[model samples]
Target chain A: MTLVKVYVTYKESILDPQGEAIETAIHGMGHNDINGVRMGKYFEINFTDDAKDIDTEIDTICDKLLANPNMETYRYEIVNAEGAK
Target chain B: MTLVKVYVTYKESILDPQGEAIETAIHGMGHNDINGVRMGKYFEINFTDDAKDIDTEIDTICDKLLANPNMETYRYEIVNAEGAK
Candidate 1:
């Protein structure tokens, strides 16, 4: 089995309202040291042992369901489950 | 400057409806190879150069706004922005 971590974030061109809201809250909290924030989605996928051609499989999944290519970009990292034991 | 990546995920005890939805969708697409999934929120917090005691700052922020500790658990890593340049 493998554990894949996928992170999807909006492109630089898009306006991230949530990120802006957090930035405003930070300023209100008097934490002016934080100039910006960007919010995103993270997924922890448990891929069963039988899954094959893993890289291609994940790519298709990301393209089809995990990310909206028009606005967001995604990247993922896979880890061997056995190594954690 | 520093970049802090905060990952907040549902505690193992809680039911993750969003994750379950994705898992069901995966199965519907004929990818029965995945048995489980957990969804999480990812944040990219950009700390200005003047920020101080970053660890404590982030800790407070996470406890107060970034997560509902009763339902979610969070972990973060601080990285030197300069190092990535």
Candidate 2:
């Protein structure tokens, strides 16, 4: 089995209201040192595959569903469970 | 510096539209075995400190800023650079 982790976040140029809200809350709670906060999405996926073109298949997943390429960007890491042993 | 990683996600009872969409797309693209998908949030925070009540402080950050305890659940790990040695 292959376990993949995906992280999706807004492009740097896009404003993140959730991150901004967290930033304000942090500052309000007397933690004035924090300058900014950026929020992102994470996923854990398990698939049974031992194929060479796995990255391409996962990229297709990202392109079709995991992210909106215009506003969000995604990055992923694949783990080979058997190889780790 | 204290490095913290936070993962926030909806409680299991809550339906995840994003995850459901991904599941449908995966099956539609001919990978039919995937049964479910759950998505969450991840954050990496860096702070400078060496304090015993660091977890409490970070919890405070989570309570007041990083997470919504009512609708979301959170878990965090603290990394101590000095302790690794």
Candidate 3:
């Protein structure tokens, strides 16, 4: 099995209320110098096969379904995959 | 400045259509054994100050703003933060 970790985040132009709230809270907690905050998501996946065309497979996944492409940006890295190279 | 990386993801029980689509695409791309996919987000923040009360500040950020506390889960690690200990 191979493990993939994917991270998704809001586009810079998008207003992130959650991030804004966090920034405000942090500043209120005596960290007045904190200027901004942004929030995003993470995913950990396990693949049972280590096929040769892994990158292509992942790319298809990303383009076809994993990301909205308009609202968010995604990046993934291989963490580990036992027996899948 | 100190850097913080935060990740947010859906709870396991939550349905992730994006993840499902990625999984299907991967399986179709000659990796039939691929079973599941989950999607999430990532954030990188630069703090301008190295205040002593960093953890508490961050906790407030998380509890009050960074995470929904209902629909998603969050975790963060410090990657780098010059002059912030």
- Candidate 1 lDDT, tens digit per residue, B28-79? 8778788788899999998988887899999988898889989999999898
| Stretches of model 1 off by over 4 angstroms after superposition | A83-85, B83-85
Descending-DockQ candidate ranking: 1, 3, 2
Clashes within 3 Å, all models in order: 0, 0, 10
What would the per-residue lDDT of candidate 3 be over residues B25-79, giving only the tens digit for each residue?
6677666856567767666666776555656666666667666778778777875
DockQ of each: 0.86, 0.34, 0.51
lDDT tens string, model 1, A2-68?
8888999999899999989988887788788897888999998888888887788778888989899
Question: How many times do residue backbones clash in model 1?
Answer: 0
Please list the residue runs of candidate 2 whose C-alpha ends up more than 4 Å from where it truly belongs after superposition.
A49-52, A82-85, B1-3, B11-17, B44-54, B68-72, B77-85
- Model 3: how far residue B74 lies from native, Å: 3.0
TM-score of each: 0.94, 0.72, 0.68
Report residue A48 deviation for candidate 2 (angstroms).
2.8
lDDT of 2 at A67: 86
Candidate 2, residues B1-85, lDDT tens digits: the string is 5666678877778887877877777888887545556688977565555445657877898887667888778898776755321
Choose 1 or 2, whichever is better by TM-score.
1
